[model samples]
Target: MIPRLKAWWRMFDTFTQRCLAVSVVLAIVASACLVQLVNVQLLDGRTTAEAATNSRTSKVTLSAKRGRILDTNGTVLAQSVERYNIIGVPDAATSFTPVTCGSKQAKSLGYCHAIDDKPVGATGAAAVARLLAPLLGMDAMELGAKLNGTNQYVVLKKEVTPQVKREIDKLNLGGIVYGELSSERVYAENTLIGALLGGVDDEGKGASGLESSLDDELAGTDGYTVYQRGNGGEVIPGTVTKTQEATDGKDVSLTIDADVDWYVKKVLSEGVSAQHAQWGVAVVQDVQTGEIIALEDSDSIQAGSDEAKLGSSRAVSQTFEPGSVGKIPALAAIMQSGVKITDQFTIPYEMEKDGQKFHDASSHGAEHWTLAGILQNSSNVGMITAAANVTNQQRYDMLCKFGIGQSTGLNLPGESNGVLTSPESWDTRSKETVLFGQGYTVNALQLTRAVSVIATGGINRQQSLIKSVSTSNGKQTSKLNTSATRVIDENTANEIKNAMESVADRWNKVINVSGYRIAMKTGTAEVAGDSGALTSIVADTVGFLPADNPRFVVTVVMKDPAGVHGGTTAGKVFAQIGEFLMQKYDVPNSAERTDAIPVEW
Candidate 1:
C-alpha cells in the first residue's frame, strides 16, 4: 500500500498535494471536536441538565400550620386557616399571554389557546387586569396601573377566598400567581377568649397571654421546597426537585371551661357596666385540684380593635388590698397560734395603735364577741385584738405560704405577685393594719388561692392553666401541676369554713341556690390614688360552695364601682355566676345543715 500511495502522489502537482494534505488535517480536527461534543451532551448529561434546571428554579419556604388552642371541653379558642396572596409580577405581566388552552390553535401555535380570549388574541397585562378586576372586586384601571410598575413581585391582594382563587384559575392568565400562606391567628371564639388566647404578631409569633408564654410549643416547624419555575415566574408542574415535609405545631388544651367562662363573663360584663367601673374580673377554681375553670377579664381587648394599652388578665396581674377577704387568712393565722374560734374578746369600734386608729366598716359601741363573730362582722378592731397572738413575721410568712407575694405558677404571661411587705419593712402601724387586711396587697387570683386553703383542707395546690400539649405525631405532654403543700392544719381550715358559713347565710338572698349550702366572704378595700391616698374601692367577694365539702371557689372583683361594699357590688356578680355554675354542674346540696358558730360568748 505504501508503494501505491507514493506512485499516486508523484503524479499530482505541488498545489494539489498541499490542498490534499490541508483537507486531511481539517477533517481530523472536525472529527475530534465532534467526539468532545458527544461526551458533554450524552456522557455527562445529568450534570448539564441540572445546571440548566437550576438557572430557572428556586427554593420556597413553606409555612407550617399553627396548632389549635382548645378549652378543656375540646372547644377551639384559636386556630390557623389557609389563605392565598394574589401575587403579580409587574414586568412579566405587562407582556404575558397564555398560549395554551382547550383544543384551540393546536397546529398554529403547537398547543392550545387562551381560555378567556380568542385564538391569537391580545392577552397582555391590560387584558389580564380587565378580566380579573371585577372578580377581585378591584377597579380595572387601578389593577392596570399596578401591573405597569417595575416591581419584580407585587401583592395585588391578600387573603383571597378559595372560590375566588378557583375563578382566577379558570381564566388561566400566565403572569398572575398565587403565593399561599397561613392566616394570622383565627380566633374561633373571637373576643370571648381574646386576651387569654393572645394574639399573633405580624411575624406569626404569639405576642401576649398564653399564646406568648407557650409560643414555641404552638408554633410548628416550617417546611421548604425547591422547584423549577416557568418563564413567567410561576412554579412549573412536575418540576419539583427537592422537598421537606412541614411539621405542624403542637395543640394546647387549657383547664378553662368555656361554658363556665361564658357565664362568668356575662355576669361580670353586666356588673362592670352597671357599676360604671373601670373593669371587672371573675375567677372560678376547683377547690380539690386548683384548676381554674373561669378567669374572666371584662376589660379584655376586643379582637381587631385597638382599644386598650395592655393585655386584660387583671385577675392575675392587678393587685389591691384584700379588705374583708384578708380576714379569711387572718383567722387561719390566729387559729394556728392556738386561738380557738370560740375564744372571746371585748371588741371596740375603733382601736388606736402607734397613734393611728383603726375602725370597722361601720362604727358601733364596744361589744364582746368570739373569734367567729369578728370574721362574720368583718371587724377591724376585733382582728387587731387577735393579732397579739401571732407575730408580724409569722403572719407575713403565713400569707406567703398561701401563694401571696408570688406568682400562682399558672404559666400566664405578665403575672403579678402583688405587694407583700416583709416583716423587716413593716412600719409600727403595719402591725395592727396588716391584721385587718391592710398595708399589703394581693391580686384576685392570689386571694382566691388563699381562701382555697379553707376549702382544700389546708393543702395549697399549685394553680395551672394548661392541661396538655398534643403534637402532630400523636404524642401528648401533660402540663397540669398536681403537687400540693400544706399551708394550715385541717382543723383550722374546717373551723374557718364553718364560721364563714354565717357570712354566706347573710348574703344568701343573692348568692345561695335553692338546694346548696354556700360559704363566702365579702371584701371592700380602699385603693390608693396616684397621690398615695385612698380614693377608690376594690369591691370583691371570695368564697366557695356547699359549706360541708367545698367544690368551687369563685372570686368576683370590681374596680372603683358605684357600691363600695363587695357584698352589694361584687356579690351580685358572684351570685349570678354561682347560681349558673350550680345549675350547670348539677352540684348536689349538703345533706346536713351548717352548724351555727357562737358569735358572742
Candidate 2:
C-alpha cells in the first residue's frame, strides 16, 4: 500500500510542474499580443489627421506692375515701382517662446516659472521696439507687444524703404521678416506734362487723360502658381506645380513730339500776353495729311483754383460767330458764280438794308472798289451783295457743301456743330448778315478746316488726335487720316486763296523773317448782344505757309480783349508762330512773292 501511494504522489508532482510551465508561456504570448494591438490602435498615429487638417498653410499672390507711358521721343511720362512690408513670426518664434517646444509640449510641460517670468520678456515689447523702431519708424514698445506671440506671426511694419530694409536685415532679429510690394508713381521729368498724361490710383489703375482712356490696354492680366505640398506644408520639391506666367502690359508710344509741343505752347503763351487779348489758341496741322503738329491754348484749366481758368481743347469745342472767317465760302460762291478773280464792285462805307447798318472796320467811303477789294477789306455789303445775287437756296447748298453749320468730324471728344439757320427762315437781312457771318455760329476748328479747303485744293481732309490701338492678342488697328471731299473748283479755290493771301500781309510786318509768302485772313467777330448790338470782339487770324505749295495751316484766336482789331492782335501771334514753325520744320521760305492782285479800295 505504501509503495502505491508514493507512485501516485510522484506522478501528480510531475503533472503539476508541466501545467505551470505551459500556463507561463501562454501568459507571455498573450501579453505580447495585447501590447502590439494597443500601440497599433492608439499610439502610432496620434497626430496624423490633426496635423493634416488643423496645421495652417499660408500663401501669397504677387501682382505685376503696369506698363509705362512714353512720348514719341521715348520720354517717360508716367511710371511705377515696388514697395515692401516687414513681418514677424511671434508665436512660432524661438526667441519669443517661453521655453523650448518639444515632446513635453510647451503647454503640458510641468516646469517651475517665477511670477515675474512673462511669456514675452518683461522688456519683450521694449526689446523688440528697440530692435525695430529705428529701422521701421515705429514705437518699439508697441512693436514688442505685437511681436509677443503665443503661436502666431504678426506684421511688424509696412512700406519701409529699401535702405531701411537693408538695415533691418543686418540686425538678424529673430522672427522678423519682410515681403516686397509695389508702390509709388514716378513722373520722370517731374510733372512737366502732368495734366495731359494724367494719373493713376493706389491699385495702379488709370484715373484720367490718355491713361484713363486706354486703361484696358495698359493694364495686363495677373498670374498665379499652384503647388502640391507635403506633410509639413512644405512644397514637394520634385512634384509638378501648376504655374501661369503673368502677362505684362505692352508699352505705348504717343504721337506727341515733346520738344515741338513745348515750343508751341511757350510761343503761343508769350504772344497772347503781348497781344493784350483775353485768351488765344494756336494749332498747326499738316495740309496734305491733316495731322496735328502742335496745339496751344492760353485758356488752360486752372488746377487747384478756378480763377482765369480755361479748359483743354479749346479750338474744336468752343463756338462763336465766325464773322469774316466764314465769308471765304461766301466769296467762293461769288467766284464759282462766274465772278473772275479780277472782278469789280464799288465799295460803300455804310450799306443799309431792312433798317440795319452794315459797315467795314475802316470807314473807306463808297467808291470804285473791285470785288477783290471788297473781300480784302472784309466789306459786309460786298459780301452780301455778291452772295445776294446767288439765291438763298444756292447759298445754303454752298454752305453745306463747304461744311458750314456742321462739325469738321475731327477725332476729338466734345466737338461742336456750328449753328447754321435754315434757308426757309432767311429774310433779305438774314441773307446779308449770314453772308458776313453775323447770323451763323461756327466753332474755331470747323472754320479752320473750311479755310483749309484752299490748301487741300478744294478738298477738306479733317484732323485727328488718335493714331493707333493695339490689342492683347497682337491685333493692331489704325485711325485713318481725314477723308477728302471736294467742295469747289480747284482753280476757283486757288483764285480765292490768292485773295486770302492778302490777309497775311499784315503778319509780314510784325514777324519779318524775310521768307515764305503766307496766305492769311484776319477776322474780328463781334459777339452780338440779345438786344441786337455788338458786345465784344473775338480776334482771329487764319493762315497757311508758302501759299504756292502749301504744307501747314495755322489759326490764332484772341477773345474779348482790350485790343481792337483781329489783324493787329491775332495776326501778330500768327506771324511769330509761323516764323518759328518755318525755322523748326526747315520748310522753304523764299523772298520771291507770288503774283497777287494789288489792293485798291
Candidate 3:
C-alpha cells in the first residue's frame, strides 16, 4: 500500500512541473506580441514596405515668381512667367511590357502587362519611336535609347508652350507627370535692355548686368520643406507637411525713361542700317540729376535678330582715342588753371617733335589768337601752346580730378575705366597728341558725365539704375543720392559752361530756339591702328539743349562709315531726339535768349 502511494505522488509532481513549463512558454509568446503591437502603433511602423515609402516621401520645394522690372513710367522691361517641367514615372504603366519598355522580358505575363493595359508583342521600340519623334521633336531611335537609360525620372524638354503641354496632358500617357517651373529674366523689350539687364540661370538666378549687380536686392530667399515620408519616398498625404514659405524677388524701378530709351535706340538703329557703320551709341543724361536717361548701343547683326539694345554700350565699355570731342574738357582744364580766355598765344605752322609730324585738322596761320579764338578754331598748335603753360603732372591731375582714368563705379556691367598714362609714362609725342584728343582713351558715359558735372552746378554724382525700392512693408529705400560725390568747384564749373557755349556758338552753331540758350561742343576723333596710323575717323557730336542753363547732355558716337564726321551724324541724332523730348514733355522754353541770336533757316 505504501509503494502505491509513492507512485501516485510522483505522478502528481511530474504533472505540476509539466504545467509550469507550458505556462512559461505561453507567457513568452504573449510578451513578444505586445512588444510588436507597441512598436507598430507608437514607437515605429512596419519598416520594409511602409517604412520605405515613408523614408522616400521627401518634401519638394517650389519657387516663387521673380519680381518684374519696370521703367520709370511703369512700363514693363523685364518680368517672370510661369513655366513647367514634365516628369515621368516609368513604373506606373503596368501594361507597358518589359520588352516594350526597353527592358528584358520574362515569359510569364504578370510582370510585363501588369502596369498598363497597352498590348505587349510586335509593337516594340521601333513603333513607339516613330510616335514619339514628332511629338518630342527628337530622333526616334535616339530617344528610345535614352528611354532605356537607368534614370527613370528625366527632363524631356524646356520652355515648352502651354498649348502643347495641355495637349500632352490630355493624352493621359501613364507614368508621365508634370512639375512647376519659372521662365524668369524675360525681357519685355526683348533685347532692348538685353546687354544691360543680362540673363538669369535655369533656376531663374541672375548671371550678369543689372541682374547680377543688384542680385542681392532682386533675388529672394530660397526656402525648404521637411516632413516624414514612407519607405518608397512617396509623400504621405496625411503626415507630410511644408514648413518655411519661399520669398519672391523684389521689383525694381529704374531712373531711365522708356520713351527716351526707345527714341535713342530707334534713331541709332536707323543710323547703323543706313550708314552701314560697324556700330554706334547715343547716351542721354539729366544734367542736374546725374541720371542716365538713355543709353543706346549696337553691334554686328545676328542675321535674324531685330533687337534695339545692342552693342553693349561701346559708350561705357569702349575707350578709344576720342579725336576732338575731348577738346572741350582739355581746354576747360587749362582755362580753369587761370589761363585767361583773352590771353593770346602765337602758334607754330607745324611743330616738329620726336620724329613725328603734328598737323592741325587743317592748315592754319601762325597768328596771335585769344583763348576764345583758339578754341573756336580748335587749333592743335594753339592748344599745345596753351597746354605748355600747364605742367605735365598738373594736366594729369586735372584729368584725374575730372574723373578720367578712374572708375565711375556706375551700376552697370562691362564698364572700362579707360587708359590714362601718368606723367612718367608720357612721351613727347603723347604729350603733344593728348593736347588735341590723342594718346589716351575715354568712354562715352564718362565723357558725357564729366560735362554733366560742369552743367549740373559742379556736383558729380554717382550714376544708378534703381531709383528707389519700396519694401512689402511699405518702406522706401533710396539707392543713390544727390550727395554721393562732389568732384569740381562751382567757379570752374561756370567757366566750363561758358567755354562750351563759345564752341557751339562759333563752330557747331546748334539750333538756337527762341527763349533758350544752347551750349554745345563738336568733337571729331580719328581711330588709330596698332601701328599708330589713322584707321577711320569716329565722329562724335556732344551738345546740351538750352545750353545756357543745360538740361539734356546728348553724346553721339557714330562708328566707322563713309561720311565719318561727328558733327554731321551725332549732331543730327541729337536734333531729332531733342525735338522729340521738347515736344513730348512740353519743357518750357528758356527765359528770353540771353546768349545768342536764333538760327534762321
Which candidate leads the pack in TM-score? 1
* lDDT, candidate 3, 55-167, per-residue tens: 45555565665766777787877777766654543333222333333335534422332124454333333333444446557786665554444454666566655665675
- Per-residue lDDT over 1-601 for candidate 1, one digit per residue giving the tens place of the 0 to 100 score: 9999999999999999999999999999999999989998899888999799877787877888888888998898888777667877787777766565554554565554342455534456776677678778999779888888667678787777777777776665654655556555677553565666667776677777777788899988889999988875678999898899888889999999988888788889999999898889889998878888998878656532333214646666788888888888778888888899999989999878778877888888888889998888889889988878699878888888877777787767667888887889888888777776788888888888988888998889888789899988868888889999999989888888888988887777766666778788998878787688888788898889867878899999988999778998999888788788888888886776737888887
- lDDT value for model 3: 0.65
RMSD of 1: 5.0
When 1 and 2 are scored with TM-score, the better candidate is 1
lDDT (Cα, tens digit) per residue for candidate 2, span 1-601: 9999768657767779789779999999999999987886688656654565434333444555566665556666566566666777565333532332233655575442222333323344445455567667777667767766664556676556677778766544433444445445566442233444556654666665545655776777776665544432345675444566667665565555566656666766776787676677667776877766665567543211122112235655567776777778888777777777676777677788778777776777665656666667788877866655677777777787778886666434345787888999977677777776667877766667777888888987766544455444655455545577889979888877888776566446753445788887777788855576787787787778878788878887887656667777777777777777788779876557647776563
- Cα RMSD to the true fold for all candidates: 5.0, 9.6, 7.4
Reference-based TM-score of each model: 0.87, 0.71, 0.79
Q: In lDDT terms, which candidate is top? A: 1
TM-score, cand. 1? 0.87
247, model 3: CA deviation in Å?
A: 0.8
List residue ranges in candidate 3 displaced over 4 A.
1-50, 53-56, 93-152, 161-169, 172-175, 226-236, 300-313, 346-349, 352-357, 470-475, 484-488, 507-516, 530-532, 591-601
- Per-model CA lDDT versus the true structure: 0.80, 0.66, 0.65
Q: Is candidate 1 or candidate 3 better by TM-score?
A: 1
